[model samples]
Target: MYREVPSARVRGAVLWWSTSPSWTTPVRILPDGCMDLIWSQRHGLLVAGPDTTAQVGTASPGERYVGLRFPPGTGPAVFGLPAYELRDRRVPLTALWSEGRTRELDERAAYADRPERLLESVAAARLGEAGGPDPVARPLVARLDAGGEVARAAADLGLGPRQLHRRSLALFGYGPKTLARILRMQRALSLLRTGVPAADAAARTGYADQPHLSREIRALTGLPPRTLLTTTP
Candidate 1:
């Protein structure tokens, strides 16, 4: 079983999920242009960075996991590192933070009923410590999420294409074009979950056609729409 709680405590901290499986299940996590702080009985506390491709893992039977997923470009703010540095990687939290700090966090998670809330609180505290995330990243990401092309988005932000690309690569673990594709795929999937036909969802979300949607989804997730939907929330 898995469940999530949407939170309002921090900007870009979308939601948290807890997972408990009765069997060792095959897990396929698609790239969502976001990052997650995860705690598991097996891995302790760790960071799941932005993935350019689907990540394959397994859920150990009888073990539990909790995760807090931050919106695209925000995880780096909370972690105090560039997202590019952690792209396509999962590393122990202690590698990024102090050993003592992560050890305490691991200990706390071992005892907490819902470790995600603790992770949320820690992220919130980090926001306060840094006086908040970069003011520009939010709007920049928003424009991209709305399907704006990279060149146009850069112009709108008063940035040159090269300038925008540099900042985007540093902040998002990829350039604007990749972020746009990821967000668009996510939007298309959300529409599909609402019972919109794939063709309509594709058109509504800016895909050239249904086949275009299928190709993009498969490219990013390594699964067709139906199978991917079963795996995602």
Candidate 2:
């Protein structure tokens, strides 16, 4: 079972998902250009970084997990480290923060029924120390989702290509082109979840055709578009 809850406390957190899969197989996590603050019953707290390709993972049978999925550009700010540094990796909170802090958080998470809320507090504290979120995050994602090309995106935002790439790597764990693709994938997934035909979803979401959409989806998910539609959420 997997379900998501709205985040009332953290800005740019798309949602918090709780999962307890049957553990008959490893789950293939898709590329969504997002980072998650994850808590595992067996592994404690960790950061799941932005992924460029599908990642396979599994839980021990009967174990549960709670994760706060933060949209692109939020992770760097929340963790006080460049997002690129953690790309395609999952690291324990202790590796990023002091042992004392991770221990405290692990204890709280072990007790709370909705432990993901405790992570919101952790994000809040980090944001406070950093002053606030980067001003470019929302607009950057908006432009890319609107189908702007990377070079054009930088020019429109009055940023040079190198500067834009640097900031994107720091905040999103990749360059603008990859960010744009991932955001588009997210849009395609949303449309598929709503029962839209793949060809129509592709056309509406900026792909050239159904095959184009299928290839991209397969590359990021290791599964074809139809396979993904069955578990759209």
Candidate 3:
């Protein structure tokens, strides 16, 4: 089971929890341009970084996990590392924060009656200390989500292309072009999930054609669009 709630303290964050069922199948985690700070019953505290492609996750049966999902460009403030450094990786919280701090968090997480609340408090505090995420994060994402071109987005953000690319690497773990493609794929998937035809979804989401959509989906998710719709939960 999985569920999420909007964070009351942190902007654009989602507090989520998941439980593994009796079966021991690997779960495919889709790339959603977000990072997560997780506390697991079987593991300890972990940071799940932005993913360029789908990642397979496994848990012991009945395992439970609590997580704070940070929207794109927001993780650096809370985690104190560039997004690119953590991309496609999952590391112990100690790897980023001081051992003492991580230990304290672990202890509190272990004992807290509402661990999700603990995650929210910790993230809110750290983010405040770091002065919050980059200012460009939201507008950039919004521009791209609206099908804006990279050059136009950079111009609108008052940044040169190279400047935008550098900031994007730090904030989103990739260049603006790559981020646009990912965002487009996400849009296509959303339409597909609503039962839109593949061709229509592709056309609406900026793919050249349905075959192009198929190829992009296969590359990012390692599955055909049809398989993804049926397999993803």
Choose the strongest candidate by TM-score: 3
- Per-residue CA lDDT of model 2 for 1-233, tens digit only, reads 78776677787685556555566546778888888888888899999999998888765777778888887888888888999999999999898989998999999999998787798888878878887768787788888988888888788888999999999999889998998988898898988888898999999999999999999998888889887777535
Candidate order by lDDT, decreasing, is 3, 1, 2
Model 3: per-residue lDDT, tens digit, 94-209? 99989998899899899989999999998999888988899999999999988999999999999998999999999988888888888899999999999999999999988999
**lDDT agreement of model 1 with the native:** 0.86
Candidate 3: stretches off by over 4 Å: none
| Candidate 2 runs further than 4 Å off | none
Look at candidate 3 and give me any clashing residue pairs. Answer: none
RMSD of each: 1.5, 1.5, 1.0
**What lDDT score is found at residue 49 in candidate 3?**
91
Assess candidate 2 and give its lDDT: 0.85
